[model samples]
Each structure stands twice: as structure tokens, then as C-alpha cells.
Target: MADVTQLIHDYLRHNKKFPHVFCAGCGHGIVLGSLIRSVHALGLPKDDVVLVAGIGCSGRMAVYVDFNTVHTTHGRALTFATGIKMANPRLKVICVMGDGDAMSIGGNHLIHAARRNIGVTALILNNQIYGMTGGQCSSATPQGDISMTTPFGSLEKAFDIVDMCKAAGASYVARGTSFHAIQLDRLISSAIMHPGFSVVEVFSPCPTQYGRKNKFRNAVDMYKWLKSNTVKVETLKDPTQKPDDGRIPIGVFRDVEEPGLEERYFELQRKLMGQNR
Candidate 1:
């Protein structure tokens, strides 16, 4: 196998930004690494790819990657990515968002983007809690979980991002964890290759905040918990067979061909122009 460090360096933006800002034991770095590997595996030109990120730990990912990047405001990465893809459909656009950034504040934008079936890939790093702005409860925070804002435990139910995307009309939807680095890479690569709106919800661990407050002991404990609590989609061949243990279902939940918004828009424009002449 190739040196993993060298492979990561191939897609990173070296310089003063050499070091990242993620806390120790944070799984965002692992997700970032998988993203880089996915881009590399596709052999996409750095100049042809555009990475847009929102405010949060996952938002900082665009700044570290060697690509045409845009750091947008919180909960607006998808909006910007949508405009980018619509304006120039040839460019590969990817949006990086945290659980709160994507599902809470930007939830409307996310669903609309999926509903439109735009040619943009959304990568949501779901660490359960809002790690960047302290350990606050987010939309994806599991019920009964403790957080800075949820001292009495979170009461709201968690959002199943994968199901939401699939229901919202995303052409491709997949879920993976930081522990499954290789599978995460493959999922991301597949998302990028998909023509319409695609979503990859990565279950990253927030060791410092979420872990410390939730009695996770350490990052390893969190990883083990993730592995044990998630069941591969292939294992549950029968649609009626649900995981009796309440484990989150992981793997590609949806992948199908669809006419993307960009393509349809351009085709309509071409027809209008021809008719006018």
C-alpha cells in the first residue's frame, strides 16, 4: 500500500495552513482525509473542483484542501454551491457542512437543493453535537444526549440525514463513519461521480466536547460505539428486517439516474433561444 501520509499530502494546501484547527481526537480530520483520497482516486484536476464550506469545524475543510474553495456563511454553503453549479455546470461542486450547519440552520436549503436535483455533492459531517460552537445539541443529536445546551438531556428526535436526502429527491445518498475510512472514500467518490444532487452523511466523532460530556471515555470508545451501533445496508437484505438493537443503518441507501437541474435548465434555454430565432 502507498504511504497514507504522502497520499494525503498530494491534495492538501501546504503553507501556513499546514496544521488544521480540529480538536485532538476529532474525527473531522479523518473525514477530510477520506475526501482527499476520493478526489485523488477520481483523478480530477484540482482547478476543476470547487469545495464550498459553511461556518463550523467541517466548514474549515475547504481551506485546507488544494482546490477552488469558497468559505461561506453558516447554513449557506448549499445555497452558494447551488448557484455555483447552476452558473457553471461543468465544474465539480462539493459542499462541506456540519450537522447543525446542514440540517438545522441550512435545512431548508438542503431539502430544496435535493428537491431540485442539482448537480452538487453535499458532504455532511455529523458528529451529533455542535462541536465548533461548544457542545450544544444539534438537530442530529441523539435523543437523551447531554450537551451544553441540553443539560437535562436532548428531547428532540435526531434527523436521519440519509433518509431525508432520499426523500427530498437526492439522486444519490450514502452514510459512512470516520472509522470506515476506506468505505467513506468510496462513498464520497461515488457521490462526486453522480450527476444529480448527492449527499454523504459521515458520522464523525467529536471527542473533545461530545465525548467528554457524554462519558465516552475516549475517542476509541466513540469509534467502537459507532461501529457497533451502525449496521451495513447489505446485511439487512429484507426491507422489513429492522435492526432490533436500534443501530443506525449505514451504506448507500439510494443511487439512481436522474435529469439534473443544470442540464434541464440549459436545455430549456437552448430551446428558447432557437425558437426566438
Candidate 2:
């Protein structure tokens, strides 16, 4: 209900630590802006919000925001976030991770968390490489792409995070790029408000890593690629089918109702306690 832009401005302007560590033209800033706006829209108490970030460039986000923030080791943010949400269902737990963190070493945890329908919103900043680790090829790295680990070109296929989340039983799954500002903000808000596991895969650009290696001059050029390549959901279904032209689909792919993990845990606890009495 609040003006999303204003809310983002207020949060970033007042928070001295934020927008500083975030690299100029970094998608982390965009996603953080959208996330702050989403939290403002939810009208949740500041004390009740918990932000968990995994190790990476994106992980630095936790250090900036004013909240119950945790910056954990690589690929473990979701696990910690899930535990926090389960222990205190009243808190709003959000897991922020990079592409490599969520899709590589964290893949198993990512899927399992979705399978359990943990009441935690997971946001992946998919920049397609291990940016902080010097541009190693990550699971989300596009096929035939070049990185520090793949000097010639990567032979492995890239993981479609949205599809993977949907298959893993996430209650809500969406994909948005940094270019789609309004849609990203809305999707993030929806993911946060969802009752069960929710994933918002944000296709961002890693200018310092992926972009430079691939010949883009800077981050703005990478943004142009994101803008030009992203396709609308209404224009087509089955986003897995890649067009020869290279357009990528970006929108809410799937949403279904499911019992959240914390609620089920409490229900079982209640029954067990009754039996003990």
C-alpha cells in the first residue's frame, strides 16, 4: 500500500551502510531495493523481520539492512533461514543468495527446503557465475559460457532455477530480471506474503565477472542484454523452450497451495503434547 519507491528511498537513504557496499549498477542493489519495498508493503514490524544472506557478493546485503540480519557461510543461508522461521513462525524470514550459492553447493538444500514448504521467502540473485570467487563457472552458468574456470567455454548445461523450484514443490515460483523493476518488486512482495516456500529467481548481470569475460564493457551493457533478452509470460508458456533468438521468459511461472512447515510442525507438536498429558 505504501509507495514502493519512496519506501525504498527512505530505507536506503537513512541506512548508511546500504547502497555503499553494493557495487555501482549491481543487481544486488536493485533486488535489495525491491525487497525493502516489499517489506514496507507487507507492513511487518521491523523487529519481526529476519534477513539471512549466504556468502558471496550478494551476501553482503545482510550487513546493510536494519533488521535481525545473519550473514552465513556459502550456500547455507536458506537452511539457517528455514530454522529461524520454524522456531518463530511470527517472524518474516527471507533468504538472499547468489546464483552460485543457491544453485551450486546449495542445490540440495534449496530443493529440500522447497520440498518441506518452509515459510521462508528465498530470493536468488542469478548472475550466472561465482563473482566474488573470481568468476568460476557455477551451476547457473549458461552453457558454452566462459569464466575463470572455463577459459575456453563451459560444456555443462545451466540450471533453470525457477523450474527447479517448481519441481521441488515450492508453493510459489517467479522469475524477474533487474530490468523489470516494477515486476520484480511485485513478485518479491508476493513471494514474501505467500504461506509456504516461495522463490523469486532474479536474473541479474555480473558485469565484473560474466560481463567482462563475455565482452560487455560495463554493467549498463549487461542491463541492455537483460532488457532485450527477457520475454513476457503471457507471450508464451513452457518457458523452457529457448527460442533461436535468445529471449528468456520472466514472470510468475507457478503457484499452488500447500501446508507451510511451521504450521505442520506446531500441529504435530500439539498432538504429541496432548497424548503425553
Candidate 3:
């Protein structure tokens, strides 16, 4: 990873934009930091990187970074990213979306993208609630959790983003949390390098909206919760770690190398063009 000072100087926007829009302890800031370091560490050119975001708290991530950013409609960031990838297969497209933005209205697009195995990185920041709009229960909100919409606790089960992407045929799928900052940095880097559809479901915390409503004392407590309620993926082999009902696993869940959608499409076009000659 690049030096902290250098990472900030190279990736951040103008210095005048001091206080970022995120809450004091919101995990979104951490995610942004990890993302910057990951991109810098990989030595990717700033111009070559395109960051696409949807309508949510996560959408604001694009504004602070110096990368080519596209802020699209609710749950449709993937569509724009797909278009960009098809037009220029060499560009590295990364979509950053909040849990509600990625899994709710945008769920169908995500499934189709994964099914096609497109060459784009989908970085889904799963805060588990509709933080920016209202403290509403999102598709990722845990069952039996209170929210603006689910006053009496949500009866619907939360969507497992990693499993969904893997089942939908994405070439790479990984899970990481804001608490594990270093791991998240590595995970994001790996996802960007992986070909075909890549999904990195990051369990970010919404201290302002989701925290106060839940039992969390504060943002620090939320980070502690992430640390306690999750286990590393490497430790799953032992039978001693069998009962992990509430505790989630954190690490890469799936990875496979294969040709992406654009590669296949362009290859077909090339073959047809040659045939016509």
C-alpha cells in the first residue's frame, strides 16, 4: 500500500474541500480511504479508473475522489457502468453503491450483470439500512431489526450479497467490513484486478441513521460489533468454529478466472467482420 500521506495527496481532490460530507464516525469515510489506498497501491492511473455511484449515501463517494466519476439514478449505476465497459473494454469500471441502492431497486440489474459476467467491479457498501434517506429497513437489514419502515422489527430476511453474486455467476465474490480496514483494502484491490463480474460486499456502518436506532452506543461500539460478530474466512475449516449462526464470515468467498461479457461480444464481432471480407 502507498504511504498514507502520499495516498491522500495523490488521490484526494482539492485541499479546500476539507470536512467531507459523511458523519463524524460514519464507515463510508473508511471505505473511501481504503478504496483510495487500494487504487494507489495497484498503481492504476487516475484517468484509467472510472467510479460509478448510485443515489444514496454511497453516491457521495464519487465527489471527493479525483477519478472519473458518474453519479446515476437509484439502483442503476451498473447500467451506466455496463455501457461504459462495452464502449471501451480497456477502461476499469468500479461501481460503488449503498445496500439499498444495490439490492433494492437495482437488484435485477445486478443479477443480469453477474449472469453476463461483465468486466466491472461492483463495490456494494452494505450498511444494512437506508441511512441517507431515512432509517428505513433495507433489503440488507437483518430480520427482527427496527427501522423507520419496520417499526416493529423487519420480518423479511436480509439478502446475502455474496451468495447472490456467486449464485448469479460472478467470477469473483468477496466479503469485508469497515472494521477490518486492511483486509478491505486488499479485497477491493483483488476485486478490481479480477476479470469478469466482481462483487465486494463491504459491511459499512451508518452511525448516524442506523446506529442510533439500533442498540449501538456509538460508532466505536458499532466497529466493535463488527469485530465480534464476524469471523475470518480462513478459520472456517476447523470444526470448532461450526456454530457461527449470527456471526458472519469475512473474506473472499469465490474467485474464478474467465472471459468477460465484453471480451466475448467483441470477439464475436471480430470473427463476423472477418467472415464478411
Candidate 4:
């Protein structure tokens, strides 16, 4: 196994895109690291991969990854990814979206993409608040959480990303935190290998913005909260076990084989061509 430094050096565009814009304790870097390791573990050719990201702190991931990358407009990463996948079905399309990007402006696109079951992997880095846009309360922000836009308290309920994806017909849906780096890598690799639409919701922490407002002492405290509050999906299945005190569930919620949209579309085209002939 290669060392962490070597793995980063080999997979990241460090020479050109070094000195990332993420805050010192932001968890986006950990999520990105897991993504790179997952790609490496799956033996994917970098040339065959296309990374798309929307406008946000998470969007910076496309810049650092050494792949065919696109920084799309805010909330448009999924739209661009869907087009890229349809145009070149051979390419592996991966989208990185922030909580606000995925659940607010891009919510419709996220659901429709999953409904079509396109072979694209969406990684929603859910930091709760809109970290890039001045830490405003986003759709994923938990109830009662304070933010710039919700100084009194966020009254809106949070969206369950994994549940939303599963309900949207995503073939693969999973949730993980930045703290679980190794497990996250495995989950991401599995999602990439899945043949249909996949959604991986990564609970990343924004120490500088969201953390400061939410009364978290620091990044370490935020991570500790995540570690203590998250329970695996499998564990929750037992009737004896119940998640309490605002514990969130994490792990692969769904994974099943299905023909992706690209495959079905090509099949339809073949049939139409035969009819024409």
C-alpha cells in the first residue's frame, strides 16, 4: 500500500492546483482523499473519468483531481454530468455537490437523474450550511441550528439525503462522514462499480463557518459529534436498537443491479434503427 502522501501526489493535480481553498479544518479534503483512493483501488483509468462540480467550496474538488474535470455553474453539476454521461457512456461521470447545491437549487436535477438511473455517481458533501456563500442556512441544515441567515435558529427541517436518493430511484445510495475515511473509500468504490445511478452523501464539517455558529468548539469537536451521533444502517435494523439523541444513520442504504439510462436509451435506438431498416 502506498503512503498517504504518495497516494495524494499520484492522484491529485498538486503541481498546478496546490494550496486548496478549503479551510484548515474543513472535511472536504478528507472526502476528496477518500474519492481518490477509491478510484485508485478500483484501478480506474484517469482518462476515462470525468469529475463535475458546482459552485461552492466542494466545487474546488474538480480543480485538484487529475481527471477530465468541469466546474459548472451553481446547482448545475448534475445537469452537466447527465449530459456528459449520455454523450459518452463509456466515461465514468462523478459529480461533487455541496449541501445547498444538491438539495436547494439542484434538488430537481438530483431527483430526475436518479429517476433516469443514469450511470453517474453523485457525492453530496453535506456540511449542513451553505459554507461558501457566507454560511447561510441550507436545506440540509438541521433544525434549530444557527447560521448567518438564521441567526435566531433554523426552523426548517433537514432533508434526509440518503432517504431522498433511495426514494428517487437511485440504484445505489449510501451515507458516510469524513471521519470514516477507510469505510468511505470502500463505499465510494462500490458506488463507482455499480452499474446505475449512485448517490453518496458525505457528512463533511465546515469548522470555520457552520461550526463556529453552531457552538462547536472546533473541528475536532465536530468530528467527535459525528462519530458519536452516527449509527450504521445495519445496526438500526434490530428492534432492540434505536437511534436516539439526534443520531443519524450512515452506511449503504441501497445497492442493487439495474440497467442504467444510457443502456436503455441505446437499446431503444437500436430498436428504432431496426424498424427504419
Candidate 5:
């Protein structure tokens, strides 16, 4: 109770805004809480944190936080965050994006961000369907899942975000479900602390647009599915571990210390200045 009060007092904005725009039972709010708790636990100065969000339901997150925030255009959160980081590398830049915002229109930006090893944390919310726009198919939607646009079921393969980011050279990458909020809190904190480009794919629940179409009774059912279907990444590495029964693996997939683009850029600048002198 005290923690909750502190979180509100320290992190949340004091604006007399109306209720949040998320649908009832939406896991986005849970994701937001996890983020707030992670930042609070880290004891970072609020002024040092910059939260940039892309257009979508996820974009709304920027407005509610007390930290420096930007609601950028769709698929451009990374670009804005990169510029912000380059301008003031001391600031802790974070991006919040929906799956479509991160992987579809913004896919190219995501690749470049990871390739450049920018010093920014990307928190991607994957609710399987486009919850903000119509309940349509998105880059993270499960293959053969039904949505408004895929009434007959989608044939397109969903992007394996963890593997994609790992292959793209992200210094740190992890995945967590809204059902596992505590673990998510840890993953987010780790991502923020990681030096290079960090990606944390959050499997949030879009109860309004996704659960009803998928035949889930309610948000609780969706959460249960997440718990039952996900296996810890650590379990997969254990030699004595039993079969995971094909459950989706969650937890840190990669963590390797590497100099970020900002560090390299400033290093080059120093060398150029020395050459001039």
C-alpha cells in the first residue's frame, strides 16, 4: 500500500486527466505499473528518465508519466529516442511501442537500432493483435489466429521478437508476459541498466480486441494461458531439465556487454579534437 502510494506520488503525473484509455482488463496498465515500479526501484532521478512512445494504444503511456516523455509518430519512436540519446547521452532513454509499432512499420528502425547498438531501452508490448486500431492482424499475432482482418485465421507467421533482436545484435534481449508482472519488473530494470540497445518484449493482453475474438472467456483465461504456455529461458539451458513441451520461453535471451553507439561516437569526436590540437 505504501509502495503504491509512493509510486503514484513519485512517478505518475498530477494532471487531472480522465481515466486511462485502455479497455477494461487490459494488461497494458499492468505493464505500465511494472515499468513504474522498475524505475522507482532503480532509484533513478525522474528528470534523467525519458519515456518515448510510438503511436498506438501504447503511445498513451507517455502522457501519464512524470518523466520526460514524447508521443512520437507511428514507427518512429526509436528514431526520436536515438536522437535524444545522442543529444544527451546522460539521459536514460526508453521507448514503449506496440507490436505493430515496433515490428511492422517500424521494423526497419528496430533493425538499425539494434545494429547500431544504441544506448536505449525498447519496451515492446505484444498483445498479438492491433488493439488500438481495429482488432486486426499484427506482426506478433499468432499464426492461424483469428482477428477482425483474419476472420478465417491468419496464415502469416508471427515475428519471433526475441530471436529477431538477438540476431540483429541487441546487447540485451528478454521476454515476459503480463501474467508474470514480478518477473517483468526485473526484466525491465535489467534492460534499462544494460549499456547497449536493449529490447524487452512484453506479452500484454488485449482483452477487448483480442480475447473476445480468440474465444477466451475473459482476461483471467488469457493470463492462465500465458502462465501455462511459457517456460523459463533458464530451463531450456539446463541439461537435466525435462522437455518444455514446446512452451514459449520467457526471460533473458541475451546479455553481452558492448560499447554503445553513443560511446563510440563521442570517442571518435575526442580523437578528431586531439588530431586538430
Candidate 6:
């Protein structure tokens, strides 16, 4: 029985199978660190952890992790992860996806997954642009943002990921950024420890794509902006108050327990079997 902190270190040192494909200041690294730490804290067996990822930069996490990772089709990580968790019921399913992968091509799956309230954790790396797909705007990208598809500026509004998940019945929802490493880890660990569906939207940076277009010099500059522009909800409790022009909200926006899909389904099954008994 190693100490929790020691266990985290051990896992990081010993789990050497995952390949690294993330950019230099990619938030995926921070998210992964937090996730691995959470798993360590939970003392979940590596073999019992199933990480499903979609086709994107963040999706590459599946290949780098030591768990039973599945690199599924584009925007299908949640669908596959749902199946895996429902079938096994014992495995801890964690879905890792990029904003475009989760909120666009996989939007239907994401909505239903949240509505189902499956006992799983979904980590969304929201870099605002489709990093792997040549820097196109994603559903999570802010309005007026510029991408390859929207050279001048984007016309469509962005989806508030936390609100969307909350509306769809996610038990726990949180938003964090690459700059808030410790807080991000805490939120992620809390999500994994939760018994119902949890989503941690991580604000990542696409330096090469988004940065260049947005006039950010590099990943570090982006990180600095993230740290300064992030607003914790508690700090903005005034009724008339709102985030600044360029600021974004970040924190454990919502967390509440609910009857997870598996639990409810099993209860119904038990009742059906009881009639025969």
C-alpha cells in the first residue's frame, strides 16, 4: 500500500508505454497529469481503466497511456466508451476528445451520453480550433474568432460546453485551462472520483494554428492570456456582473450526484428478474 502521492510518482515512472504527440505547451499534458493522479488517488487498477479517445491531437492520448486505451473513430470516443462501461460495469471508462471531435462530429453522441448520465468521465481538450484538421473553427470556438475556414472572422456563436453538459444531465461539470495546472488536476480527480457522468472542459492552446492567426507569439503567450483571462464563478457572483470582453470562466461550475444510467438499468433488470423469481 504505497502512499497516494508516491503511487502517482510510481505510475508516472513505470507506465512508459504511452507515446507523446502533443505540442510543446499542449494542455493535454496537464489534463493527463491530473487524470493519472486521480487514478492513483482512487487506487484504480491500470488494467481496469479503459481510456477511449477519438481521432485528433488529444485522441492520441490513448496511445500514450498504459491503460486499456482505444483510439476510436473521429468523434466516436464517447459512443465507444459508453458501450465499454455499460458492458463491463466494473471498468472505469474515461473518454478523451478534442473540442471539434466531441462537440461537432460527435455532438449527437455527447448529448446522449450526458442525457444517459453514464458512470464515466469525459475530458474535452478545447483548443478552440481543430488542431489536427488544419486549424478549422470548432463548435467551442468563440464568436469572431478566425480560423482557416473563417479567415476574416467566425460568424456563428460558440456552444457553452458546461451549460450544454449541465442541460443534458451530466452529474458533474467543470472548466479549466492549461495555466491552472493544480486546479485542473483537482477538478479532474474530483470528476473521476464522482460516481456519475463527469465532464472537465480543458481550455487548450493551438499555438501554431490559433496563435498565429490570433496574433499570439507562442504557446507561452497563450498560457499567459489564459491565466489572466480566466474568471472563477465565485468571484463573479454579482447579479449585474459579467466576464470582461476577453475573459472566460473557469472552475468547478457544477457538481451534483445523480442516478447513473448503469445503476438505473441494473435496477430495472433486477425488477424484471424478480418477477420470474
Q: Which candidate tops TM-score?
A: 1
lDDT of 6 by residue, 183-272 (tens): 887888888877889999999888877888888988999999998888886678651344756578788867888878988998899999
The global C-alpha lDDT for each of the candidates, from Candidate 1 onward, is 0.92, 0.87, 0.91, 0.91, 0.91, 0.85
TM-score of 5: 0.95
lDDT of 3 by residue, 14-133 (tens): 753767888878898899989998898899999999999999899988988999989999999999999999999889999999999999989999999999999999999999998888
Query: Which 10-residue window of candidate 6 scores lowest in summed lDDT?
Result: 10-19
The window of 10 residues in a row where model 1 has the poorest summed lDDT is 237-246
Candidate 2 C-alpha lDDT tens digits along 7-45: 666555354643367566778888888888778878887
Candidate 4 TM-score versus the reference:
0.96
Candidate 2, clashing residue pairs? none
For TM-score, candidate 1 versus 2, the one ahead is 1
Candidate 4 lDDT over residue span 146-184, tens digit each: 999999998899998888888899999999999988889
Cα RMSD (Å) per model? 1.2, 2.2, 1.9, 1.7, 2.0, 2.8
Alpha-carbon deviation at 112 in model 1, angstroms: 0.2
Whole-model alpha-carbon lDDT for candidate 2: 0.87
Best of the two (2, 5) by lDDT: 5
TM-score of each: 0.97, 0.93, 0.95, 0.96, 0.95, 0.91
Backbone clashes, each candidate: 0, 0, 0, 0, 0, 2
Which segments of model 2 are wrong by more than 4 Å? Answer: 1-6, 12-19, 237-244, 275-277
